[model samples]
Target: MVRAAARLPLFFLAASLVAGFLLRAPRSQRVDSEAARQSPRARTAVAATGELVKSLRIGGTIGTLRSAAIRAPELRGSHVVGWAVLTLVRLADAGSSVEAGDVVAEFELKRLEDHIADLQSYVTQAQASLRKRRSEIRILQGAWQHEALRARAESAKAVLGLPTAEVLSAIEAEILRMAAAVARARGKRQAEVERLRALVIAADLGYFDVWIRKELLHIERHSRDYKRLRMKTPIGGMVIRETIFNRSGEYAQVKAGDRINSGALFMRIADTSQMVVRAMVNQVDARTIRVGNRAVVQLDAYPGLRFSGHVAEMAALASPRRGTRSAGRMFIRQIPVRILIEDKDKRVLPGLSASVDVIVSMGQRGVLIPREALQHETGQQAGTFVRVAEGGEYRKRHIAVQGLSDTEALIRSGLAPGEQVLLKGLPRDQRR
Candidate 1:
């Protein structure tokens, strides 16, 4: 009787556990079905009919349309001059506003000034020496004239004695003839000496004159260099520091106390009134882009800023894409394009990252949607599809694309205005 009662309780417990599991299974499945119907896994967008504008977006760097580059002054004075490297003493701070004819940079003029002073001293000394040489030549010429006059007088006296000898004895006549011949010869010798001395004096004067002129030229050249050492900006604009190789041979922004090579550009002054964006477009799109095409420029740094612009120029030839490799035999070619920004703003600075939206096609009425919403059907069903939202589920439908821009796609068929479409596609169960 005790065993029978224990068995009865065990059987009753087993029956209750089986009934509880059977009751809960249907409820759990019902809750899951309700949740799936209420919540959406993919975000949806409404299809719209509007003017579809197609634009080609290209990235570029901002630059001034008119700018002047400041370079280290070249040593133009003399070939064998001092200061092989130009040491910057004072430089205009970057981003500082400057006016025309403003001093943008100043070098250590100590060496240059000293060099100019030494050259001037040399020039002064040379001028004095030249003057002394002229005086000496004049004095030598006077001495030559006096000696010639004395020789002529001696010859005349000897000739007169020869006539006296003719009236005397034969021996006296012979002695007079010899004295006349000797005097004539002495005069001729003196004339020859004077002629040679005159030529020598003329040569010496010419040499001294050339030397003086050379020294004067050196002085002038050094003076010009001295003026160049004080660098000045030719136009009014903001100063921009340039990256250059420092004394340690590392690339860095140009600053005071840096030594730069002659003629190396160290800074630039940009004309903020007019700006430009230098961009590169693929060769495939190059044919469609033309000069004077309207464009809108947006800066990456300042997302809210937009500037109006137009295509100013395009490169004639295409260049090979740098830092990229070709998939096979064909390499990518990029065509350079320059866009001139028409809008003037203080924030439009050089070297800013910007994007240009070159309007290729004007607005045309068509059904448009976000390009990401369009999906491609694979396998046996091969076509473009977009998932439409209906009753908490997605329906895949074929759509015909008329045109695709950088951001939006123009739909030609299989989609209507005001229909909600999923931006992302769901699984097979969620998408009918």
Candidate 2:
């Protein structure tokens, strides 16, 4: 049932075509006696005198060729309690004029501020700990030095006692000599241990200083992050909100209270000093439009106004028309083209819906012929011809065609102005 409901529009379109099919008048009949026909080509029209201009109609929107984009604040690497995102507190209204240094967006800084405070406190504690450790290392150094000096002093005293060995018994002399050697050995060992202990203390102090420095750096980075909560525009321009995909998979403009990922495009400051009409030409008519072709643009918002421009650039590639998934699936392609407006108007604004007519050829009082009167035969000798009504019969005349559009042809030769041309019903000799 859902499938059938979805196809109802198609069924309605088919029904409308069937209902309107009878209203359209068929073209000329065939030649010969039996080809006497249905709907004879009796719809005759006289060639009129006028300027005939041929052009291609393309639909597009008014926009600038280039624009400056305002991006969201980069807060990606600052990890605290996980992957942190800034809360949007303020957003500039779309279309509002903003200047340099104007705050476009502001994020909630309370969290970052609190984190900064925590880092500062940690740094203070780390510095204090580093200072206390350094003091303790100094005290240990003094104690170790004194112990080493006292051991050396005892060894000297033992050496002095050894001088008495010559005047004393042999056993006493040997004991004095051994005591002095033992004191010297103990002093050397104590000095070696003190050197090792000093090395440990130096390493500990270096680590302590490094830890404190890291804490201070972290604090500085957090303070910078807190300052980054406010985003500013580099130049003054009218604000244009940038569209981003929401969690629901739909694109929407970034606004206040919206949590956006780091580095996401948040807004645009359009360079409106120069405006261009960006149009898409269908592939069938794309080749006719080229760079340097003249175009006239009409804004849908202001129906009475028109602006002239020239094709500044055209896309090197074609793509399925954007904004429609069905177009991609159906393989319908359109070439993008830009026309720079020559005359600037204050009322003209970006994003306005506009219709652009790219002039193919401008006819200057050329003879115009109705499209139905011309026959486009397909062959080597295939020429564009028109049936002329002369003296109770129609005669086929091959003519030099200047340009032909969808509805009319601008004739360079052959047909004269005010000449009556046979249409729809044709003479049997002229009909196929």
Candidate 3:
């Protein structure tokens, strides 16, 4: 039994040693297999000969080709009461069509009425004064005529050598002078009457001479205001905006009694018949943007839809935003580029945000490779690697990269088409 027990201990120790060896051997084999699978193999550098060179892209937005703003008219009188919008018969809605000489709006005539009344009063006073003047002139004329007639009779007697012939001659001369005076008085009276009549007639017709002159002067002063406030579409197009006062028994924020300031923004209008994409480029990129440069516009609201356009113009000057500084002292230059679209729909609205892509250049056919292939060494050398068939190794090859994009680079030279290049990390054994 003692010998069997000692033998059993040795056998058990041998079995444990074998099992440990078997477990360790499989683990070592597994490690080797995994390493082999992870290692990179030799790959033939193939050339990608396809359309690689494409147009350079720039950004822009969709906008209206034409736009307008409506403003208030310049009216006089601080105490001038509220305004009454009198739409002329021919006036149309913002998007509606209109003909020339259409009345857009008219002011209330209360002030004008008061002016007419005051003028009438002045006319009445003028007529009364004129009548008094005429009566005085007539009385003077009558007295002068009587004296002259008596003197004329005396003169006739004198001429015939009657009694007091010298006195009579003097009296007859006085009568002739008195007759001339009466004629002058009559002429003055007639002029006064005519002037009064003119004043009265003008007042009766609601047309005061001075007031008419003033009205003309007012028209001259507000001509520009009228033109602006009329809010006519400079070109024939669809009205994209309109301001309609609601008359649903709700009092307006500004009413007939409320005062409005001159130059207020009363309304706005835009022409939507044609649309454009307006893009603002940075000062650095603004120089590259020119009229007639082709572009692509994308709306965030409408994804996957791209509209094509061209740069119509660039602004002459740069205008910065208020109270804000630009980055890198690079003021936001004014690059007013208009991108025209052939199709205009309701989807395009004024002030809708949009993105624009301007084509700077196009590379139709060129050699391109993934950007990851490029590697920069400590010596500041940029190059890529190509795998060699021999012993699964890679050769460090230098290539000239012309243009680089987000995902690829344009290979100018030092590489041929259908050439195989290494991707990802190098083989673990080869990595230093």
Predicted structure with the largest TM-score when compared to the true one: 1
Off by over 4 Å in 3: 1-61, 76-260, 321-323, 326-334, 366-432
Error of 1 at 130 (Å): 3.5
**True-structure lDDT of candidate 2:** 0.80
- Model 1 C-alpha RMSD vs. true structure (Å) is 8.5
lDDT of 2 by residue, 157-265 (tens): 9877876888989888888889999988987898789889978987998888888788787777667766778878877777898887765677888777777777677
Tens digits of lDDT, candidate 3, 80-152: 4333333222334444543333443334444445654565566566556656666765676577567556655
**Poorly placed runs, candidate 1 (over 4 Å):** 1-49, 77-79, 134-142, 324-331, 375-403, 411-432
Which segments of candidate 2 are over 4 A away from where they belong?
1-54, 159-170, 242-253, 281-290, 320-334, 360-402, 405-432
Judged by lDDT, which candidate is best? 1
- Considering TM-score, where higher is better, how would the candidates rank from best to worst? 1, 2, 3
lDDT, candidates in the order shown: 0.87, 0.80, 0.58
79, model 3: CA deviation in Å?
Answer: 6.2
Enumerate residue pairs that collide in model 2: 40-425, 41-424, 41-425, 42-425
lDDT for 236 in candidate 3 is 49
